[model samples]
Target: MKSSNVFYLVYTLSLLLGLLCVIFVITWSKGYRGGFAWDGSAKMFNWHPVCMVTGLVVIYGNAILVYRLPFTWSSSKLILKLVHATLNLGALSLAVIGLLAAFGFHNKMHIPNLYSMHSWVGFIAVILFGLQWLLGFLCFLLPCTPLWLRAAYRDVHVFFGLCILAMTVASCLSGINEKLIFVLNAPNSTASYKKLPPEAYLANILGVLLLCFSLTIAWMLLKREWQRPNLHASALSDATEPLLTED
Candidate 1:
């Protein structure tokens, strides 16, 4: 397929998945608790899913794709890099707030924290994400850093960024399953997998949509034509060429 066609297809799927995620979370929250709060109650827990879907999934996915945007090709590389870093910082901030909400709610309810597989993996992913962002800034964005170091770590940065995305998606899927099971097995509950409730279906669809979103982003990143081209010469020079610009 042509790169433009692939980009459009993936972009459309990303939008659909993002919309589905928001819709499902809002619907689920309203049907269960009517609205969200942060008062150490179950209502406060609503922020968990909402923030995760909005920040970690939607915004984070787009941050990774910012440079691949065709319109950005004409922009200065520094401007694109700044935009990318800013979006990631926003995502990290939201994810941190979501984590705090979850932990606060659990503590108030006398529920243990970090006991489940979802928590374990999610915690690790967040930690890795923070480190990745910090190192990326220091190595790539800082004016004092040597150009060779940035060049050396560029591939490493890309690798870890994709790894974090995969981990986040997996953690989200596990979290959805865990929540559904907990709700269905609660006292006097009528919902079950065999006779699934509307919420159950919504959760299932959300998971599928998230998976599709992640896959599309991954495909877009891997496509050669969709990757960002090196439009300017590096700040450091080899034996044959003169340095033209600093990133």
Candidate 2:
């Protein structure tokens, strides 16, 4: 298949995956009274998953693709860089809120934090994301930085961006499984995950959607046709211009 066709196909699927994630979260929230709150209840804890998926997974994925859009081909590189940074900042803000909600709920209940691999990996991914965003802003957005430095860091930025996305997705799946296990084993809950309840199916669907979203974003980033063209005269002037431009 043509690269354009594959790109659009994956893009459409990624959108569908995002929609499914929202629906699954809303359905679960409604079923369990898991609405957002600052009261440190289960509802407040619900905000963690919802925000993480929406911000870290969905919005972040789209932010990485902004430069790949055909309509942006003629747009100023500076504008695109700003848009990219702005979107990432938005994602980081949402993710921070999500983490706060989780920690607040746990602390209120006297639950231990960062005891699980999921939490450890998720935290690492968030930290790395923050550092990536900071470096990108300093090296690429700031006029004080030499063009050579920005060019040199472009590949590293892209590489780590994709790595962070993958890590987030994997951590999300692990978290879903962990939550399900806890809920199923709780004394008040009558249904067992062994029985494959509706919630179980919803969790499974959400995980699949997360995976699809990540895969689609990765494919789009890796596809040669979807990459942004280097139109800057300065970029072309470099004898050793990096093969990959910033997203």
Candidate 3:
């Protein structure tokens, strides 16, 4: 198979596999009233480790595609377009699957705090990413369109892309720290419930901090874009008689 197909297939399959892993992890965590211990609770379940490792791998693998997209083939239009589409669609799928895991699908399963935050934030980030992808696709697909509209679309796309990237980082860190899992079960933790380690608390704070940073960066980019002019601005300026007049 061609490189593109390989990339697409691996990326797509990773997404599906990651979805399954997420589902299984959520299901496994339901047994723990407080925070589930990897050694005591998760090790007993075959799916937990599989889900955690595979889901994580899938997320990282997808990031590889994201990284490759802009820099790898700066001169190749066709390849760039294909990679971009794959990342956008694949990210969307992961986001949806994550949401299902968090929302307690079928009412039989629910991931605790860490997983829940991971899911919700992931979904929001994906929503922002989808908007970014939609606007980008429109800008590229509609080259004959008005310059002003194209510029506006591109600006929106750039700003949202940055947002998605930030959210992606937060989601990944939350997943790694396993704090999101702890947060979900926080309300139920008591004398009868198992207490989480100090590490989880730190992770939760980090998650919040990461989210704040992401939002702050996104706002900064949006402000910058709003103040900047599009390529058409130069074109419009060039068309005026003042610049064209032969001194």
Candidate 4:
């Protein structure tokens, strides 16, 4: 099959899987966990999972893929940069709200925060994501930066972006697992994850779909034929590496 065909096929699958991940998280949060709220209750904590998956996983991937879209490749570089930065800003906003919910719930319930590996990883990932977005904006979008210096930093920016994405995925997986163990296997809880209850299955499936969605995006980036051809140095600063791995 042709490269375009393959790209479209995987692209469609990535969209479907991303939507499914969002749906599954919402369902699991509303169905198994208490519904969402903002009053510093358990329901408030529910927003954490929903926001994290939708923002960090789904929107984050879309932001990175915007530059790779063949149709968009013809658009002005300034336009592309604005669009990319806007999407990332949306993602970061939701991520901030999610963090607030988690911390608020913990404080309200007198529960320890940042005690688990998931929390540690997720906290660091969010910090790095914010930093990456700021640096990318300063170097790429800011007009004053020297072109040569921007070019030099472009590869480094892309490398860290990919690393942050990977960290986000890992954080999500660990978070879901941590949530399951805490909710299902707790002393007073009736359900046991060891028995593979329906909620457990749904959350686990969500994790799997999230992983698949991320991998599909990575595959699209790694396919050299899909990259825009002969773009100007300014427009394709990260083009130095094929895998790109995009901000």
Order the numbered candidates by lDDT, best leading.
Answer: 4, 2, 1, 3
| lDDT (10s digit) by residue, model 4, range 105-210 | 9999999999988999999999999998998888777766666767777878878878888889999999999999989998987779999999999999999998
Model 3, 64-159: lDDT tens per residue? 344233234333433444566665666556555444443443133333433367566765766676676676666544445455665456556555
Q: Write the per-residue lDDT of candidate 1 for residues 1-247, one digit (tens) a residue.
A: 8777778878888878888877887788778645888899988888888888778888899999987888777776667778889999998998899899999999999999999999998989889989998998887667677667777787799899999999999999999999888887787677775578887888888899889889989988888777766523432321123222333
In order, the Cα lDDT scores of the candidates are 0.82, 0.83, 0.46, 0.87
lDDT of 2 by residue, 50-138 (tens): 88888899889999998788778776666777899999999899889989999999999999999999999999999999999999888
Count clashing pairs, candidate 1.
0
Instruction: Give the CA lDDT, 0 to 100, for residue 199 in model 3.
Output: 38
- At residue 2, candidate 4 shows an lDDT of 82
Q: Assess candidate 1 and give its lDDT.
A: 0.82
Best by lDDT: 4
Clashing pairs in 2: none
- Candidate closest to the true structure, highest TM-score: 4
Off by over 4 Å in 2: 1-6, 230-247
